[model samples]
Target: MDPSFRVLLVCTGNICRSAFAERLGRAWVDETLGEGASRLQLSSAGTRAVVGSGMHPDTALVLAGYGADSGNFRARQLTADHLADADLVLTMTRAHRRDVLSLAPRGLGRTFTLREAGALLDFVDGGSERGEGDHAARARGLVAALAEARSRRPAAGDDDVPDPINQPLETHSEAGQLIVDALLPLLRRLAGAS
Candidate 1:
């Protein structure tokens, strides 16, 4: 099926936002796509720090709130191999995007901030009110919407999900909520396509 869609979620440290996003994204894809979810490969990594650790307690807590399973999640570091294999690389912020691009020059076209990608979907869904007529058409529309949003906000930098490591539980909860909100729609679109 179009050569399996591989996605990589990134952040500064793998313990917090990236880990949460990774699990949430994976869950969303699995729930939405069902059997086809096997075709969608998902993983997460850190740009620095947090190379090999379990997800932060707060991250797990926040994910549990959304009914997402974070029990098996673990921290991992970004690698050239990961970059090479990914079809889409979503970073928590613009800085992480840039760092990923530097690591995998070839991924420039596919790499993007989760917020930017989410914004694109927002523009498409918000503008046409299409109500999911045709999957291909809708996908195209989403891409166009993202491009338009991107054009209007050229200075738009990373809307990276803030790191909640060692921060208050409230901060972790807030960060998880933000991630779940952003990922929900994207997951819907991907699942719809499948």
Candidate 2:
């Protein structure tokens, strides 16, 4: 059996950006990989989460627009265990990435800002639509490939997906769009469909 590849998404409060990305990623996996989606696990948390709180209302609306479920999601605080178990940790911002690393320094190679991962995807060769692997294998390969590619370039100045918790609907939508912009490509690569 292929190993399950775990992905952890992180943000400030886990009510907006990370929450939205988790649902969007799961929906994309289900739609793209069908039963194969079982080989991958996606989860989210926050540096200073509003623990036990539901996703922000604005975030839920953005997800609803994408036809994704926004229910049954309660925010949780980031922990070393979450970092240790993950094969990839995608934070909403560079600061979140640093927070994750501080919790689990060994996760450095596997951690990146969501936008950074998406940008790095363009530099990786193979392991896309023509890749040889199951969903888990593909995801693992994608992480490794991204790690190698990360060192070749300078980190982007605009890698953070801005927080939209207290903002208006439009701001939430923009943040949601930014999350998907970075997330979709990574999901495609994970499913070996890029």
Candidate 3:
């Protein structure tokens, strides 16, 4: 059997965007993959974390409104070691992608913004039966497609997840929705959702 895919999410602070992505990504895995969710391990950290902070209070409110929970998350700083560890580094911004690459040059082919991953997944989805056998195989094809996209001229960076720290309730909620819109569908495909 193939090894589990490790997804490490990165943002400016783990308290907001990355933590939120982790939750939403996990929810998609659970909902779409069911017993296969364990095949994809998700975690998050900050490019410049506060180290021990919890999720922004309003983040919980936003997630709760969407029927999910932050579930006792604590922030951690991104490190070179972590960049080396993840099978894929999903960044909240292009800067975070560069940050991961600077720390671990070998990550160049494996890291992408959530939306960037979406774009590449589209390419793979449009033309492929090689990855049709199983949930994990299709997910692997998607990851391979993302790396292929990174190798080309860096694709445009329009899908950045905005930082919502210290923002109004509406802004926080918007951030949540933006992330969900960008992330959920891609995750569903990874978990073999239709």
Itemize residue pairs with steric clashes in candidate 3. none
Q: What is the C-alpha lDDT profile of model 1 across 139-173, one tens digit per residue? A: 44444456556655556555778878879999999
Which ranking of candidates, highest TM-score first? 2, 3, 1
CA shift at 108, candidate 1, in angstroms? Answer: 2.1
Q: For model 2, which pairs clash?
A: none
Q: How accurate is candidate 2 locally (lDDT)?
A: 0.86
**Please, what are the lDDT tens digits per residue for candidate 2 over residues 1-194?**
54677889999999899999999899988888787787767999999999999999888988999999987999999999888888889999888888898889888788999999999988988644355655566667778888889878785779999988777899999999999999998877776632
Cα lDDT listed for each candidate: 0.75, 0.86, 0.78
For each of the candidates, give the backbone clash count: 2, 0, 0
RMSD to truth, every model? 3.8, 2.1, 2.7
* TM-score leader: 2
Instruction: Evaluate candidate 1 by giving its C-alpha RMSD to the native, one decimal.
Output: 3.8
Stretches off by above 4 angstroms in model 2 are 128-134
Candidate number with the higher TM-score (1 or 3): 3
Among these predicted structures, which one has the highest lDDT?
Answer: 2
Superior by lDDT: candidate 1 or candidate 3: 3
